[model samples]
Target: MPVYKDKNGTWYVMTRCDDWQGQRKQKCKRGFKTKREAQDWECRFLLQQGGDLDMLFKDFYKLYEQDMKARLKQNTWEHKACVIKSKILPYFGEKSMKDIQARDVLTWQNELLRHRDKHGKPYSETYLKNLHNQLSCIFNHAVRYYDLSTNPTAKAGSIGVKNAKEMNFWTKDEYMQFSEVMMDKPISFYAFEMLYWCGIRLGELLALTTADFDFKNRKLRINKSYQRLKGQDVITEPKTKKSNRTIEMPDFLCEEMQEYFSMLYDQKPDERIFPISKSYLHHEMDRGVKATGLKRIRIHDLRHSHVSLLIELSFSAVAIADRVGHESIEITYRYAHLFPSKQAEMANRLGELKKGGGF
Candidate 1:
């Protein structure tokens, strides 16, 4: 038997029953605003308790978080989780997994465009788009395995971002100035030198171990990268298949690496080549650049400088791509303009051909 009351304090319905053993069950629950809502809840509860809806909101969210963390790399998970904590949870934390819809996602996307962070910087189109992408990925897993009715973000499209002009790499003189600034810091100097000569990523550079090098053979192996994981830094395998490669070291760098190896001979096999934290290295580099009045340059720009120098030396695009571990030669072409002086050199070569008077 059951009893229900409306919002206005009026009774809606009452039911009673007696057991076969003549036992009376006195269950008097009230407070639903309407008879229909109470009836609907009654039916839903019965079905839900009988396992008709096995996937609860908390269960789906738990699975979503687990799958996202497992599939995404540690840095990626941390970044994406920042977005979810700051943006997604406030809106949808209490939302039912089954009731989420495309409109809800669309509204969230629109709101994100208008929202700004505590720092007052508006969200970039790329950031918004990536957040949507991560959300879609989460929902996709839920839809595929958790029995979600539909993916709320299925219709979401990329936020249209205009292409910006390519950036300029450091000129030879700029590199010299940067070099002069870093001369006193051996690790910083050698790290920058390796970037300009070896085209290794910053993370890969930090992940280097003495054993990963063969100074006598003048070769450097890149197999792992230092990535931030769970708020701590850890060494992990390269981010992509193409990210693992061996590079030939210049004679000067080979000499330096040999010295570095000799100095580290007493250290453990797993010790970091540059035992300094990334933040400390960045801080030192910034101080050096400021003291020398050098042009502003990002750490990544050192790798860009390496690729540019190779291009200026007329290294084939395929070779550069292989050296830099780019999956495609097209990506290598992005650095072609770094050797723009070749335009004039090619023009001169064309003039020489014209002197022969041939097409």
Candidate 2:
């Protein structure tokens, strides 16, 4: 009833529906080459209009993307979109949303676990977890919106591959040694110094501008972050609400920043403090690591090192979380083991108290 032939012999599907406000409206799609295609399109369109479960995953994904565009940040949307297009769609694109069962999802998860990239290495657990999360999100969205009766991901337990590799971080002595080698490269030295001492994320560090700093008050504001997604540089809000915070810089670091500012010709308020790309930063870090003959770690380890140092100095978890713009103290607790053990000192004090007969 909804299919018709166009003037150029192509077929079209048109459906009339009542809008949310009760007004009648027509939804039409053209350029179908066959009557069957037109009828299929009409069927799906009508089902979608009636909020029935009749669309394929690929079709539902289009609607999901439109819903997400208004709710998610640019970087998050882009990441999810990339995952869906590259990983999820290839396997489940044509499958009906209602027909994708737990077993099917489990099979896909196993395939992902066994999948090897060009490097012949299986995807990291964190990456696998992210991919699983994206899949779960799509299914959950479908269930919540009544497009599907159940979420297959709910029963597809633990799709993420748990790798036991320990996270890498540097101690104070190692960082000091690395800094000694970085001294010759002024930009790298300053950048690493801020990263280590401030404990800001790489994106937050890259987003820094002259106006964000207050040398007189020894404070720095973190309100935004910079990221490269889909080969484009994007500036967006900080990762979380708590990430938008003010940090009081140490006196020595404040002085170093002042000296660094003096050498820069462009001192405009909006001028970027560190106008370097991620690749350049990695290059300098690699050179410094090799020259210092220290344990190689990612640039992000500098943030971990900063937290370790603060914990060593007896800073509370809340204090460290505030300084580093962590969403919660529980995140800081992840580095609890890195804190220097005070057990020996506590035992020594107890011995002294016993010797003095003070209980």
Best-performing candidate as measured by lDDT: 2
Candidate 1 colliding pairs: none
lDDT of candidate 2 over 233-324, digit per residue (tens) = 78899998888999999999999988888888857887678888888999988898788888788888788788878888888888888888
Measured against the true structure, the TM-scores of the candidates, in listed sequence, are 0.72, 0.87
Instruction: Specify the poorest-scoring 10-residue window by lDDT in model 2.
Output: 158-167
How would you encode candidate 1's per-residue C-alpha lDDT over 82-107 as one tens digit per residue? 88777777776556667777888888
Q: For model 2, what is the C-alpha lDDT against the true structure? A: 0.84
lDDT of each: 0.71, 0.84
In model 1, how many backbone clashes occur? 0
lDDT of prediction 1 = 0.71
Candidate 2 residue runs with Cα over 4 Å from true position: 4-10, 17-23, 161-165, 340-359
